[model samples]
Target chain A: MSIGIIGAGQLGRMMALAGYPLGLRFTFLDKSKDTPGAQVGDIVLGDFMQAEDIRRLAGEVELLTYDVENVPVQALREAAGDTPVHPAPAILEAAQDRLDEKQAFARHGIETAPYRPVDSKEALETAIEALGMPAVLKRRRLGYDGRGQHFIRAAADIETAWEALKGAPLILEGFVDFDREVSLIGVRNRSGETAFYPLSENSHEDGILRLSVAPAGQPALQSEAETQLKALMEDHGYAGILTVEYFEKDGRLIANEMAPRVHNSGHWTIEGAATSQFENHLRGILDLPLGSTRPRGHAAMINCLGRMPALEPVIRFADTHYHDYGKSPRPRRKLGHITVVRDDRASLDAVITELMPLIKAAEGGE
Target chain B: MSIGIIGAGQLGRMMALAGYPLGLRFTFLDKSKDTPGAQVGDIVLGDFMQAEDIRRLAGEVELLTYDVENVPVQALREAAGDTPVHPAPAILEAAQDRLDEKQAFARHGIETAPYRPVDSKEALETAIEALGMPAVLKRRRLGYDGRGQHFIRAAADIETAWEALKGAPLILEGFVDFDREVSLIGVRNRSGETAFYPLSENSHEDGILRLSVAPAGQPALQSEAETQLKALMEDHGYAGILTVEYFEKDGRLIANEMAPRVHNSGHWTIEGAATSQFENHLRGILDLPLGSTRPRGHAAMINCLGRMPALEPVIRFADTHYHDYGKSPRPRRKLGHITVVRDDRASLDAVITELMPLIKAAEGGE
Candidate 1:
């Protein structure tokens, strides 16, 4: 069977690679003719917002999905009329808008940070009063990876934050003091079979993910977070991979955000888990039996960004594994990632500890 | 740097897939334009034996290798002058000719089945008198998977065997009462570092490989066999994947034959080993440090031949992994394989035990 995916980026390319072994073909729709996924996919080059592109993609595939959520919800709904779109357009709509997402979590009895919708100057004034100073003002829709968001650390910063938002629909969220961030990635098939990968502790620098350690550091917190995420997916009848970002503070896990598709933090699954998140996503979408989720070992994944040439030392480590995404070396571009899996947490920690030094050496040689 | 492979069959396709995460690009040369590997590779279509095609491929790649040994050596030599054809022409020549291979083994003090060269009727008579009846007649070159060989069971069978292999250079050998069959797959780099995968106990039906169980059944015998094979590779300065077939009888390992490229029996390494044989082969040929040969777990690999729809049951088992080669369906064609890996040998045995019932079910469905 064939699958249609919107946004032909690295995620779609990886999905295509994972799906090939299962006898599934993928057709990717994108605005650019040479998007990363198009390198190994059947491409339909047209605007993602255009009805004709959506129609063409839906006509050729047995199922429909997305690599990114920026596609217009109307376009997805129209395409869903022909082929089944897993996770549904409603889920995408809720996820795309920060205000709607937070409200939805509250409705489901999930814990989330305090937030208030701010669509105009008057709304911002009322939200600031209730939320107090030192809050984050973010565009309600289309914000990702810390983009389209600004922190209001003082009373003097509120007006600047409002102006920086460029008159977009926005939300003001009260800051939550948390110790560390983690994520739970799970997959559910059409038959209601759910599989959860071990939770991963994530670290980010300047808002871009830097490292992820799987089976997270805290076992009780990981299990509790996974159980909570799986319960949410089950309640929604979600079919496909679901990633729930969370914060741990004083031994309590708080929901931070959710992604209906595969997330970057789960990349270590490619080498550490019995089945990768990408492969599990395909299996879920295809209504196939889910593979094992048990991890092969403790794994640490480090993202390769900017002009880093960290391949030499990474390649020298017996346990270190490199995965180059085959993209041009643009600044801050995610060219690849290195995953090192070992029997103990200490071994994995040792690899992560040396990541910076190795990257520096590779950069120096280049 | 990029490498060019001369066939887009499963071997070349697998090599390309393995190379993907390593940031290695491959250009595949094949007659079929839409070979499986072509979906993810740069394909150059033309006759592999043509001088112009060889020259173009050589110009496009930094290194050259063949996915199969059938590639005409003369064309390769002309295209890759000092570029290094891994396993080299000398290795291929020895492997291609049975008489030459046996002589070389003898020269190296390796034990092999008793055999004699036969180029004419007089030579055949001399061979028969020396080897006795209940022997086999085989063409000296261009034989694979049971092709180009026949058994001479009785006096009447001699005429038929001779008629079958009339005009080709041949060898006659007395049969050995082997208890089982095994193979050792190893890699050697230019730096003289050698890595050997655990021995695989193989089972065949009509000379076609049916199954391979890694770490074999006899650990001590397997280890001894691997030691012998490693010595042979080091002695030859071999710099790629090598498969050596052996016969075990009365607790003794006897050399049967050898192939200087990736072999079907080593397919389990994809899921069982820390690094796959295909990736190691590339690392070896590139003179990079050899990867760890540690097996992740006990693994059983079963080849899928003909149009059997056995994927469902095999996938149902939690540990079972599948690989489909995407070849046109034929009665006895090897389209893919399934690998099952587990923490212990008992679990592997249990998986294989479950496999028998599923194979029977598939046959009944057919």
Candidate 2:
């Protein structure tokens, strides 16, 4: 009767909010007794590595999925047993490692920046030679946002960059001449039926997602993104939501990374689309027929990082929607997001103009 | 931190659903441990009169509200202490008694069917003498749908009607030659700022509400309904949602009853309006600026009484939205509802024609 989620974050909380109206029950497996998801649904407090806890959660629900990509893939597989674990642990495993993610993309004929594994100083030197200057060095696993990446400009900067990221298995990724950052999300069901939402043009500040505009640019770019996404979904046999973030350069989509679960860029779908990504993800996992993925209007989503802004001005806008994650305010953590949706382009732009400054001030930004 | 609701039925369940994305927490007090609201938020199982349980819930939340009119008014007043209770217990008490509700409407210059108190068989005879034959006899408190009414069509029927309802104080009222049944829901914040949703034309079967069409009929009727609603809200010193059901005959509005909390007919506002009645109720209690009350599209809501239909066909529609209140199916009980919203009248009518039969079958209709 209930759906179990591995991580109790904003995405899990939103999924519960969407699923509740459909008679779907929700229970979360979270490490913390108090979490954003716990505020909305039932929580089973335990670590992801606890096999007993994972199995206990699986036994209580009809199916399993996750909010975060950092979960232990094998534990999910082991716990799922005869039950369905959507988007599959294999997909999570591929998304967990940067080297494997890029390699998987290449195998699926999706373009990616050239990269090579770097373990020792000799391997790093060889990779630098092959990838060229201004290459980025990153830890292969447990990396998020910009936490694990260091840019190497020249040979002199190598030692310091290596000292900063040494101990973990690393990958050197060559920099691409990208014009803009965009993300495409597609959902697939167990029956092989697939639905894709609009492409989201994204902006990140200090490696944290700051803004996303839905139906990014125009139709042609979105079509190409969909083509690449469908290929990835078919190749992996994904059964829930999958998102691929791309760097658009000279009208070409070069894959930067893919999240096996829902992405932050699709938050606008809650108010902008006819059916939200969260509900579609549940529908896909449940193997129900998917809903329409069409956008109702133009949407601009701004993340509320570090602190929650007062909601008075935001709700005053005709079609604006505010979502708070109910997490404690931190220096750089994402606290919430506000989405402004409008049937016309002008109202959308007007709200975006008025909101950016307010959100920026809340985040202690310049 | 959290909003405490007294009755954990579908209404409280929905309030929690709407409030969660706004970073609101919810806790409920209900007699039943297994309630629809318990699936979404914390539930404190206790009777409404249990002061200890009510006090504990009040202690845990920022404010309190109720989903049903059946809760003990004095207990809520006792538990609220200094913490705000929206739509005030006074309004709840007024809504509880049919006589008082009609009197309040009359005080606000809203016309109602002619009525008189009937405490005894002698009083009932005198009331029928003034109101005429085919008058209706109703108990003053704790009645819903058509449960507490009996018709006095002839002299022979008077003894039977009196025998059935003589113990309780009753009201004998003349019937209105109404052309249609419509309801208007208006919300007022503590600041006295008011917003009204368009009138909803409703259809009832066997005294239980069956269907509601939003943005009902013409603008003139909606305006008159809004005017009467504003007067009632102002007279009650009300905050939060209030709904007034009306009988429209000869282009005149006659108030039948008023609900101090969110009403069933306004359920379409969840998906049809830019902002839902649940969210606005929370905003009113918290004194936040209300969201837009404009309709996003035309909406039709059909109640799924006693059973739930298969969800596959419902979600397959591009604009259909399904809600299941996780209660066990029972004969003649209010179960769940489905709302379908569309941008045009043709599609709205098309969906209404498509859904009525399916919902009727699910409810085990005759």
Candidate 3:
């Protein structure tokens, strides 16, 4: 069977890699043949935003999925006429906008920071007054990695923040005084068979994910996160991997956002878990039996941003695995990642401490 | 960097899968585009036996390797003029003929079954008398999986066995009444750094490999096997994975044959070991630091001969990994394989018992 992926990024490339062993082929829809996915699978050169282009790809494959979240939901719904698109386009519609996402979470009884929709400067000031002084104003759509969002620390900064993100659908959320950030990845099949991986504690630098360590968070928190994710998947009638990021404050999880796709925080599962998220996503979407989400060991994943460190120094560590997406270097680009699997969390932390400086040095340039 | 593989078989396909994470690209040389390797990487449509075709592939990549064993050594040597072909063409020459392989093993203090070269029918009968009534006559070259060989049970069967295999250069060997069969896989880099995986106990049906369970032999036996493998690699100045099958009789190892490339017995390493054989082969050939060969758990790999069982039933067991080479069904053809990893050998055996019947039934043309 062949699967058509809407975006040819590293995620799609990994999905193809994971799917190939199950006797599945992949065709990627993207503008360039030089992408990471194109290097491994057939390429259908087209724009993800165009329904006709998506239809061209949908015509050739048995199922459709996307590695990128920015694809237009209407285009996907129209293009995927007869073929199935997993996670459903409706879920994408909800995940694309902040207000809709928070509403979905609320509907599922998941807790989130206080928020109110803001469309005008008058509404922004009113939302700030109602929510409190410390808040964040974010565009409702197409915001990721700290983009299209601004923080308001005081009343004086509220107008400046409004000025910066004006003329777009916006949401004002009360600032979360988070102690730690973590995420839970779950997979559900069409039959409603679901499996959830242990929480991964994530660290970010300038809003870009820098490090992730798996099997983090307390068991109570883990179970709570899984229950919330299951409820969300059930609500959406979802089939595929779903990731929810949470802010932990005083032993409680405040849901921040959800991505209806395989996530970067779960990348360590490639070697640390019994089955990886990419493979489970394919299995769940294809309606096969979901694999075990058991962690094999403690694992840490370090993202190599802007530039990748030399392969020799990284792989020299025992049980270390290197991943290079075959991408050219550009400032702040996610060129590759390194994963280290250890028997215990302390050993994992020790190695990460020694490994971080080398990776951080390379991010400056080469 | 790109590597050119001489044959687009399952081995080459797996090598590409392992190399991709390390940011390597592959181009393969084969007559048919409908091969396991071609499904994942670019294909150079040509015959592996033709020197000119190999030269075309060698010209396109920085490094060269082969998955199939029958490639003409002269062709590889001539084609890979400057571009390094790992395991070295010289090692391939030594491994191609059974007599030369045995001689090379003996030089490294590796014991083998007693054998004598034969030319004519008269010579075959004379050798049979010297070796004994219960013996085996095998062609000296291009023989595998019980092909090109005949068994001599008694005096009446001697002439018949000679008549069956008389036309080729042959060897009559004293049959090994072995207790069990096992293989040791070892890797050497260009810098002569060496690593060895634990021995895998193997089972065969009609001389075709059916099952392999790794971390099987005693620690003393593993050390002995490693020493022998190191000597053989040092003698040849070899780089890349080398496998040697052994007949374990009364706790002693009798060398059988050697393959100068990645072997099937090591497939369990893909999930069972800290680092897989395919990745290690690439790291070795590329002159990178060799990965740790620590076994993660007890693992059993069952070859899916003739046909593959349904993915649903096979993958129902937790920690089970399925690999389908996408080959058409043929009687006794190696089509795919399933690997089961468990925390203990008893658990591994239990899963195999349940999995075997399903796979065997599929081989009957399901």
**Candidate 1 displacement at residue A365 in angstroms:** 8.0
The per-model lDDT (C-alpha) reads 0.82, 0.88, 0.93
Report model 1's TM-score to 2 decimal places. 0.96
Least accurate 10 contiguous residues by lDDT in model 3 chain A: A357-366
In model 3, what is the error at residue A255, expressed in angstroms?
Answer: 0.5
Better of 1 and 3 by lDDT: 3
Query: Quick one: best TM-score, which candidate?
Result: 3
Tell me the tens digit of each residue's lDDT in model 3 across A208-281. Answer: 89999989979999999999999999988899999999999999999999999999999999998999999999
Residue pairs in steric clash, candidate 1?
Answer: none
**Lowest lDDT block of 10, candidate 1 chain B:** B357-366
Tell me the deviation in Å of residue B122 in model 2: 2.5
Return the lDDT, model 3, position A94: 97
DockQ of 2: 0.78
- Give the CAPRI class of candidate 3: high
Per-residue lDDT of candidate 1, residues B1-366 (tens digit): 688887788888788778777777888888876687776677888777776787788788888887877777777788776566787767877888898888777777778889998988778878888989888899998888888998988878888989999899999988877898989999998788888898899998788888999987467876787777787787788888988898888888888898888889998988788888998888888888887778998998888776545455678898788787777667667777788899899989988988856754554454
| Candidate 2 per-residue lDDT over residues A1-366, each given as its tens digit | 689998899999999899888888888999885788878888888876676788888888888888988888877888778777887889899999999999889987889998999999889999999999889999999899789999999999889889999999999999887899999999998889999998889999999899999888568988888888888888888888899999999998999999988789999999888889999999888888887888878999999988888888778777788899989888888889999888877878888999998887877852
DockQ of candidate 3, scored on C-alphas against the true complex (2 decimals): 0.89
